[model samples]
Target: MKSFKRKAKIYLPLLMVGAVIGLLFTNCSKQGFDAAVAEIQKGDDPFLGYAWHINNTGQSVFATSGSGVVGFDLNMLKAWTSGLSGSGLKIVVSDDGIQDAHEDLKDNFLYGVSINYHLSTPTGANNAPPNSVDDNHGTAVAGLIAAVGGNGVGTKGIAYKSKLIAYNLLSSNVAQLDERIGQQVTGGYDIYNMSWGSSQNNLPVPVAVWGTSLVAGVTNGRAGKGSIYVKSAGNDFIVKCHNSTTTYCVGNANFDPDNNMPYTLMTGALNSMGEVASYSSPGANLWVSSFGGEFGDDYPAMITTDRSGCSAGYAQTLNSGKVEFERGSDGNSKCNYTTTFNGTSAAAPVLAGAIALILEANPNLTWRDVKYILAKTAVQVSPNMSNVTRHPFYNYPGDASKNVRLPTGAIWENAWVTNAAGFKFHNWFGFGRVNVDAAVALARNYSSPYTAGPSVIGFLMNSSPSPNAIPDYDAAGISSTLSVGTSLRIEAVQVQINISHNNIADLGIELISPSGTKSMIVNMRNSLTGIAGFDNDIFLSNAFFHERSNGTWTLKVYDGASNDITGTLNSWGVKIIGTP
Candidate 1:
């Protein structure tokens, strides 16, 4: 569970439980090595059969109560046989400290390159290790990224041979947060996996400095080819509306302002059945999704390396009130592994490992090229999701007089939008779950003109109207348009909004591209329920990827609730970031 904070200052040092994995195929067997590619050696890794994320065949992932859908996997066996195992790449697990001595990770853990921060030394230092029993998230994260393969003891990682490093920035104080960001840049690593995120409330979180750092990483890091940054979309799909409300509310991935940036890949989580993981935060910023599974006891979850012994990690021998899998039983008597590690936290690392394989296939490909490849090859899962609208506080028994009702005929969430570029995108699954084999095949022959350098041309087109009054409880909300003239093959779209409302969560925001593609940027009845309105806050959407940025972009703001709260759209604008 991620620690939630509501403070004036920002501190992102907490763990958020989130969502991927897979191992060997029982029937899809290959004999010996291929002639052209490197030898496909899975070694004697004993638990390979239990890794469904690597190759799914309806296996239960070590749980007896549930089963996964066949063919809902990363499809890595083909890529692995073709010699794309992410060798010679450095991946940084930017979360809690990693157990460098863990048997599955020691061979690949890059010594003296990882950093750990303490109050005594705010600048951070080498020798990163778990600070306490609570600091155990990164070890599981590392195992998912590049736990050593073959040596034959535990489960294998997605990129089993890739170099691994860690940064214990979550344990650092808020005073050194800037130093932590700087450290993220100082390390010349190829990919950074951030499996944690801040709260889901909408209180206008600042991102100017963070965006600057992300730009620096993609522009100057990794010898100018650009380092890839993968982040979790969040895991707060079902949460309390507020401190006082008992009803559960939906958490949008866009609530966290950091996820809206174009420089990082925001990933969502899916279950073993190829469905949206129940807790995955949905939003328009998600680039792709991966299996994060469910709790490992009754349902299938992730299988990864835990703390070395029973008494230290999630799987303890003597632990009481825990499931059989987490208590050193059910073929895990040695207490060396855990099957309950699921979340977007799990999903981010899984995607990171896939990115490592992509880089290995074509190291010359730029970050933008990698993103484009993913967008091109992603597979859309659960294609039947429909448009949804919510009315959380409607006819509240506690305060019926202050009842809330969503405006009629207003869609709070869009089903699936196929842009003019022929790319399909969904808020729950992004472009779709990652297809490792397809992505690798594309990477082998992929090249982008943007590889010379990032020509991320950004232009803002603001609305001419000063302020438009919004109607209360009306589906016909204020509509503003920004006619973009710059010719850019759009990669990401950001909408800067300035509004004043008593309950911003009651406001549903939508962006319509000139190509007639509609994206719900902010869902109604979100975590921002009781807050005032936006003040130049920026919202992002990846649904417009590869579209032409040369037409009118419409922005619609709806007062979805009947709470008698009036608001005004002070000013709004569109900022397009992409290559010309």
Candidate 2:
């Protein structure tokens, strides 16, 4: 029996946490953060609220609808925001509430609701949240998509001139199940972000609100219907995010059933260093990873925001220049800047924000086009970064193997000698990181009939982001640069990111600049690739800013959220082009 247990432990690490039964990952805040707490942002501190700090700022977050935005390095996000200003073209941001009310959000917002959140009863508003208790998730998500542009007081987002919408979903049980079908079919939303999760314990009365609604929405959206669904990577240590309740069919290997719309895109998360987050489930059904903070020794790798008015106000007291962390769950709050997290809830917004930037570049893009560009234009990463890298919060606690980088070629079979750095395509990095340069180049060089922006390969995001800010790269720090009209066109901005498994979308996505300011760009729901396009087409774009400083470009992937997008990627190619 002992031998069997030993073998199970050894082989099961690569599989789902279920194979060996896993514990809940880090408590969302203090896992490996004993070393980086003093660097917390004290609200409104220039360059202080980067991705390492945790502040929800009363916004409706993208993935899984959580609170608090982890802060990033200030300088890093500057590069991310600099490229946002442009003329003739207005950037459009996606939101859950359909109404972005952040202090910095832009005026116009693109609204759309997820099918699941729609009311099933014939006599109801079909509100996504199904309550009057201000589900900040929707507002939080809108804030990430498009906060005020050119606003220097707060953090910056991926796009400057954009709008948002509540895109309501229903959490309460309604009377008519047909309402579910009607909401999905009628809501003319461009992209819908779904950060919530399910395992069956909630016992949803089988209605139009099933997983199929997402597929239908994506199908219609990608087909130029201005409808797409950005789902979160289920927060599970299993194959299909199958927690104790929900059971995913894709894990069955024989999941070859049919559906109305198989066009859903899911996302996952990575750490501050661009590697998969420790708590990040697996790369199985994941799609991409966005910067979720992870900078400085004094702070943890996190995506920061102004969470002063959020539900977990206790954890976000220091946001927007206030002290709130001092309090415990009992209500007493503590005031500090640095914070930590672990889940897909954090990663989804990042990808969504990137897409918003791409949309800014070309307003005529469709959901299908967005998927195409993502998969086809991505950077390759180390092989076992996904399988070998254990979830720091749950696995390898006190185990020496957790910190060790695997030998070259150990992850993939017959890996190239140059791959000694451990870079490859797999669950760890779905086609590697998103190449902002390639994507822009494609938009500039190509003239495809399907897509608009120079045949742009994909959205914003770079390959490598770090060095400017060692250890944790809150925002891109020294890793990236933004050229309004100096280098790349203002309408053309991109970030470095890893499109990993479509899971862990709860982690927040952030952007920081040189001055130490920051912003939450996309939610975990937005980080997934609607399709699995090709990999490597360097011709997308690359810039050499003659008047730019040498900054380390970094893309932090959040570790949260997931959906059937894993299967979606395998079936469809990542497309870029769609208006939210």
Candidate 3:
């Protein structure tokens, strides 16, 4: 939430300014944009128009598909014509595996730097190519990031000219995965696109090494300019809540602890109609959002490279539930491309590609500069949505006679709040949907104030006040206050809690900044709702970014479920990363 001091409310005007600057700087005219669009319309790729993420004009992507909302795209046409196609940048796709020779992706693949960790030596020509249908993920993910463009090929990528390095970390050991995120054997990559997450929710993974790597990458990778790490906020919004057939959503972006890291830029998803995707998980940790269409069967989805040929992949001839394009019943007889790739998986790479374009615009920009540009230029969607609603856990099972409703009767979701720094944030969409055109324009003129960036071992303060008993099914939660003496601007905040409870999901945890900005880092009724509580588990939030850290900070934990069992707030600590 670093204050850009720019008028972010004038979003459309900012976009126009970006377009004008891009056109003027590249010496391209509006006719150039039109000519590029006309070339695509004349069938340069035969499917570019269907790729609504690049430029949405409400055209159906497949035979039986419905159209998306007009103008709800990445607005990349101007950026593309302005000579920003992510040239000279390198991206790492850490996932299952990739079809390196796929028609749409082969041209951009970086052979020498890629790795196949499943192999004995873990490096060579066979750099983790797809071995089965299950291994088709990385190929699609790669296509979203760097599939070749305007080559009279299949579809265009967001960063068409960016080089890609593939890694089969999904099939490798955890140590190798940790290395990929941290200091790699070949360690000069620019952006790391991670579309994977932990299956275990509300449980701590061994992220200490990965967390250290993330800090190092942002501070020291890419020749000291810092490497950008883009990750997918999980795709579990529609999952069933704990111990119930009812499909109540309990997914939060912070559930996967990897996303909680300040260095990790987590992105949520937007569907074809320019709304939050039904399956996109929501939390305070999300930085921004990008397109991840609905299932391609009924609506348009991402069109990207799949496994080679019809022998395997989602586009295989015999694959079930595929759309017209994927089944090869249409023009895709080779079955090389699939139109069914969708999720935060797709959304994350979209942001990564956008980051690539920003870097290409100005490679001198630091990691923090890139983040500031994005936050400054993001477009707020669903602006009219109410900021307060009846709390989701207000009606949880609790003895009416013994437990009373929480006094603060509302929960904040889908609502925008302008922090003290004049930066607006929302739980559903952090800053808002990324405006690539505006972001690129800002990046071109941006300079980093944080020349050295935040240190790896951030400033930490702990509060181990005497344990307090949390009321059962009551709104009156126990609160602990800590007075801080450190004076520094905030970049991100992390809170580690040790709580003892029968059912963890029944609890809600929030951090109230000295500025009175209340951020619910962990929500109630998550996947761990019926599980035992955590001890010393850490959660992070970006809601207080750019705010001062020299005031009183408060921690509140409450139980929402009606049960005889109660929980104890054992101890909690805080860590803040930013400038002094």
The best candidate in terms of TM-score: 1
* Alpha-carbon deviation at 405 in model 1, angstroms: 4.9
Count: clashes, candidate 3: 4
lDDT of 1 at 300: 75
Candidate 2 runs further than 4 Å off? 1-49, 52-100, 106-134, 170-186, 200-226, 238-262, 293-301, 304-342, 384-424, 447-580
lDDT, candidate 3, 547-571, per-residue tens? 8887888988877666667888877
Report the lDDT tens digits of candidate 2 across residue range 1-580: 0000101111111122322322222223332232232343333433223333122222111112122223211112332434643222222222223323334543444323223244453222322332333333444444444444444444444433544444343322222234433353344454455544432111122234544555455445434435545544534333323242222211210011111122444554544433444334333223444433322122233433323343332134333422223222212222111233234444555556566555555556666556556555655444433332222222333544323222222221111111111222343333444544455445444454342322222343333333222112111212243322112111112332333333422222333322222222222322222323212211100111011211322223332222322211111111122221
Off by over 4 Å in 3: 1-43, 63-66, 124-126, 172-186, 240-249, 388-414, 455-462
Superposed on all Cα atoms, model 2 deviates from the true structure by an RMSD in Å of 16.9
Q: Give the alpha-carbon lDDT of every model.
A: 0.76, 0.33, 0.71
Alpha-carbon RMSD, candidate 1: 5.5
Over 113-181, each residue of candidate 1 has an lDDT whose tens digit, in order, gives 777675355333555788777777889988999988888788889998899887776643433355455
Per-prediction tally of clashes: 12, 202, 4
Rank list by TM-score: 1, 3, 2
Off by over 4 Å in 1: 1-41, 119-124, 172-176, 242-247, 320-322, 389-405, 449-467
TM-score of each: 0.89, 0.48, 0.86
Least accurate 10 contiguous residues by lDDT in model 1? 28-37
In candidate 3, how many Å is residue 82 off?
A: 0.5
For residue 544, model 3's alpha carbon misses the true position, in angstroms, by 1.0
